[model samples]
Target: MKWDYLLFYRWLALNMVGFAILWVFHMNGMVEPVFLADSSYIVYVIAGLFLYGMVLCGFRVWKTSRELNWVKRGDKGKLKEFADKSRQSDRESVKEAFEIKLFARISFVKYISSSLVMLGLLGTVIGFIMVLTNIPANAVGDAAQVGKLVGALTNGMGVALYTTLVGAITNLWLNANYNMLRTGVVNLIAAILESADPQ
Candidate 1:
């Protein structure tokens, strides 16, 4: 029933660092810069990174759980006994795992989602600014110039709306998947331990 304490800690550390970085980006005003930019591609890149980080967290959790000592032992009788105890221990550990709790805590999602929403709003604002500044000067100024400026604003608005949509969808997706996967892993470990216990 021995546990690999190091694996648990390492898993936790990685998750914490990832979430921390995500939070930092949000607090630092990612939305402002992305919105005011001349283009929307940078916003896409940032959003992609954020999504990747969430997926990475999930993989780390699953991999760490798989590497536990109890799970690796092959002797049925002994493995069961050990796995049962290890399951109990891991259950306790996972219960207290802050990294898991972070998924539940709205702070992480809120910060990330809010940043995304803000980024969208910023895009919208910039788009509005462009529209206002590019009025035709000639009987129609350069129709092309005004049209181009207006077009930029429309693009910005699209970016803003899409970013916010993505942020919201991702927050829900990440939280739901993480909970389901984590719960399933813990429950399976518990079952293995129970079945392995000597009757």
Candidate 2:
């Protein structure tokens, strides 16, 4: 079967385009407010985690593509080394081990992706707590305190909404990259196993 060895590179290019568009939106002041309004700073944390995930995804893609190329050129690369060192003649066991090795490399990306959403939830809880704790007992009767109370409520709401939005969006973005990298890994494993097969 013919394989597009450039698959991972193409996927990485798509991710870069998506990020470029996001950067354009950010530069035009479209997304800046949502980011800035989150006083809890959870949005910033989410962004950082997303960046880290992207880096890991890129690295995985590069490595997988290189290994696939090596296999395509009849090098067998790590698969050959593993089969030789382990002295395992069962193709199934070797395939399973190779799959595990590939997946293990990017496990941290999965964890970081999950943590993004959880942190957003943490921000939301903090926001609600801020809202509840800032309300003065006399807010209903005291006009002067009412203004301050309303301001506090708005701030809390901003934090809640902004963090949730950032978290969901970043998670989706990172997941897309993860899925692409995963597909590459699957293809790489298939290629390796096929090459290793004895005719």
Candidate number achieving the greatest lDDT relative to the actual structure: 2
> What residue pairs are clashing in model 2?
none
Question: lDDT of each prediction vs. the true structure?
Answer: 0.53, 0.81
> Mind giving the per-residue lDDT tens digits that candidate 1 earns over 95-180?
34533443344234335544555555565565555555554455255655766756655665655565555555455545554554
Query: In model 2, where do residues sit more than 4 Å from their true spots?
Result: 1-5, 85-89
Q: Candidate 2, residue 86: CA error in Å?
A: 6.3
Clashing pairs in 1: 120-160, 138-141
TM-score of each: 0.42, 0.90
Give me the runs in candidate 1 sitting further than 4 Å from their true place: 1-38, 64-149, 185-199
lDDT of 2 at 86: 48
Count clashes in each candidate, considering only residues at least 3 apart in sequence or on different chains.
2, 0
Best by TM-score: 2
